[model samples]
Target: MRRLRPEPLTPEAFAPFGTVIEADPASAIGINAGFTTRFHALAEVEVEGGAPILSIFRGRPRPLVIDMLERHPSGTQAFVPLGGRPWLAVCAQAPGAPLRAFLARGDQGAQYARGAWHFPLLTLAAQDFLVVDRAAPERNVELADLAEPAQVALDG
Candidate 1:
């Protein structure tokens, strides 16, 4: 098993896997008497005829040990944090390749592209997230057991 450190989450770095949703004050469009800002189209929701389902995911803080990963072949999936807390995002180009981690803040969200291998939801606190994903009739998830697990470390 190998240890890996998490990089800061950014739209450019995470572009390969998916989109990073963050409300940037400068980029957001102002509206509502100059009191509201909007970061439009933060992530692309590609369902491809699959029903979009919304669910809530509650997660607790724990050690980051990458033992397995999964992917949705039918459609893309997204996770938007409901609470203000930092969480870890682990992903890889492929199942056998090295895993990369990102530190997502409370305000940030992520949408994984179809067939993107990623770890389950991870967080430091008991935080809830709003998830929008496709509902497929047949099982659309593929899980892979990693031969070697990696311990994810935090980057300063």
Candidate 2:
């Protein structure tokens, strides 16, 4: 099995796949009578033929083994953790390409670009995530099995 060590998730490092959703002070705007700091437009939501829908995903901790990856060809998928718990985001440029794993902070979120290959949510604990994605009747998911499973190392 292949071994992968996840790097810290940053906007620059994760740019190729999609945008990283986080509260960046550089992009902050004060609103609501200057009481709330709004981090607006952190990510762009894309949809080809479906409407965007909001859903909550309750993810549970699982083994750090990756055997396959999936993608949404019709729209972008975003995951924002409701519980403050660190998680992993596994992505690749394409099928059969080398995978990139990111250690996302509890306050951070990820928006996978359309057609980008990524593993399903890898939560460190049982947590709830607010998901933004497309809702349509047509099939949108495409799965590809890796030639060899990859084992993820949690330690830095």
Leading candidate by TM-score: 2
Model 1: CA > 4 A from native: 25-27
List the lowest-lDDT window of 10 residues for candidate 1.
40-49
Instruction: Kindly list the per-residue Cα lDDT of model 1 for residues 90-146, writing each as its tens digit.
Output: 999988798999999888999999999999888968899999899877787899999
Q: Give me the runs in candidate 2 sitting further than 4 Å from their true place.
A: none
TM per prediction: 0.91, 0.97
Residue 24's lDDT within candidate 2 is 94
> Largest lDDT belongs to which candidate?
2
lDDT of each: 0.87, 0.95
Query: How far out, in Å, is residue 99 in model 1?
Result: 0.8
lDDT of 2 by residue, 1-156 (tens): 889999999999999999899999988999999999999889889999889999999999999999999999999999999998999999999878999999999999999999999999999999999999999999999999998889999866
Clashes of 2: 0
